[model samples]
Target: MYTLLSGLYKYMFQKDEYCILILGLDNAGKTTFLEQSKTRFHKNYKGMSLSKITTTVGLNIGTVDVGKARLMFWDLGGQEELQSLWDKYYAECHGVIYVIDSTDEERLSESKRAFEKMVTSEALDGVPILVLANKQDVETCLSIPDIKTAFSDCTSKIGRRDCLTQACSALTG
Candidate 1:
């Protein structure tokens, strides 16, 4: 009877879960964004120091509960080799957060290529995306307008899915 009651209680209070994927090129601050998000959302969560965080060779998983919904974040490694594995999780993710290093102008093209590929993937069709132009704290960083212009080619591939480009400083967030 106790076990039955416990199960019933859990079922009554279970939160809806949504899986979100964090993707970007290496050194684009994906991990920092994840750490900052966890710290901000989970009152008691003690995320690693931003300076001490290293490249994620595999992935980092974090869960945040807001109201009656639970968000599961998958922070994947962004090295060129690791990018090939991104599609493996596409089918399971409900949303995608693509980070871009605003200070790195040279890599903007490469980032655009990657973004286009991601948006065109059939596995992720119609998945909402949030493109973050990171490093906005830097005086020389690219503005949101610049990032948008650079990625304009991808607009058609993005289809009817919800998408937004916003500037952010993960270190300060």
Candidate 2:
């Protein structure tokens, strides 16, 4: 009875916590998305200047509370060298948000390769994936359907894991 009451109390009073990883190729707006989420979900958050935000060499951590849940975001560096370190965090994350530069046609293939590698990792086998086709504010950006089509094979490779692809402008949001 004591254990049951304690569990109930914890569930009712403590916020559920989840860890999410933000990943993408270089200049794909991962950091911008983190900052935008913080600014939108956190009260009194004085976010940094988007223009001043440079390439992330390491990880930038952010936290936000929504409803009864607390979400912790790990925005990792997207450089080719940094990608080797992503698997280290795969076991600890509950979900992944992969950002893509919709306007960069040249890097789409490279991004697809990296994304396929990540999604197929045994450590991340069942994790949910949220692919953000960023830079939608640009006139030349690819549409959501086009982006989906480009990554369809990679998405299929994820097996039974939940995956969603959405269009977004991290800079504007």
Candidate 3:
């Protein structure tokens, strides 16, 4: 059974569609990240204006094909009121990209709480998580290591799940 399941997983990953959720607190750069990703992955893609990107009231969906993998991304709104809608997409997401506004020290605690809540969900078990410490281009932005330390508990809660935390500038990408 284990071998069969492993084979099925490999086959699906190699030939089927995959979904990724881009989640974070409001103004944490989720939409910017999605736009950047689209610009980078899609050929001749005319990306959105970073300066004009506004808060996401609901969700922004994007798709890109890289090699044989057709990736569908759900960039969900991160407002406190919209967080309830996040879990609805979790069960179908193959991976998660959790963004954080590295320059907003004031909301670090709130972000941490939200991250902890997401990572603890049973639906996300064994899913790979990429925590992007965004807004690094800001002069006052926290360093990647500092951001990681701030969410140490959240990462620890992702037990046995593959997770990577990195600093990035969504605006510059």
How many steric overlaps does candidate 1 have? 0
Worst 10 residues of 3 by lDDT: 147-156
Q: Can you write out model 1's per-residue Cα lDDT over 114-166, one digit (the tens) per residue?
A: 88888999999989999999999999999999999899888889999999998
Clashing pairs in 1: none
Please give the CA lDDT of all the candidate structures: 0.94, 0.94, 0.92
What TM-score would each prediction reach against the true structure? 0.96, 0.92, 0.89
As a TM-score, model 3 comes out at: 0.89
Query: Candidate 2 lDDT (Cα, whole model)?
Result: 0.94
Q: Give the candidate number with the greatest TM-score.
A: 1
Q: After superposition, how far is residue 164 of candidate 2 from its true place, in Å?
A: 0.5
TM-score of 1: 0.96
Clashes of each: 0, 0, 0
Local distance difference test, candidate 3:
0.92
What CA RMSD would you report for each candidate? 1.3, 2.5, 5.8
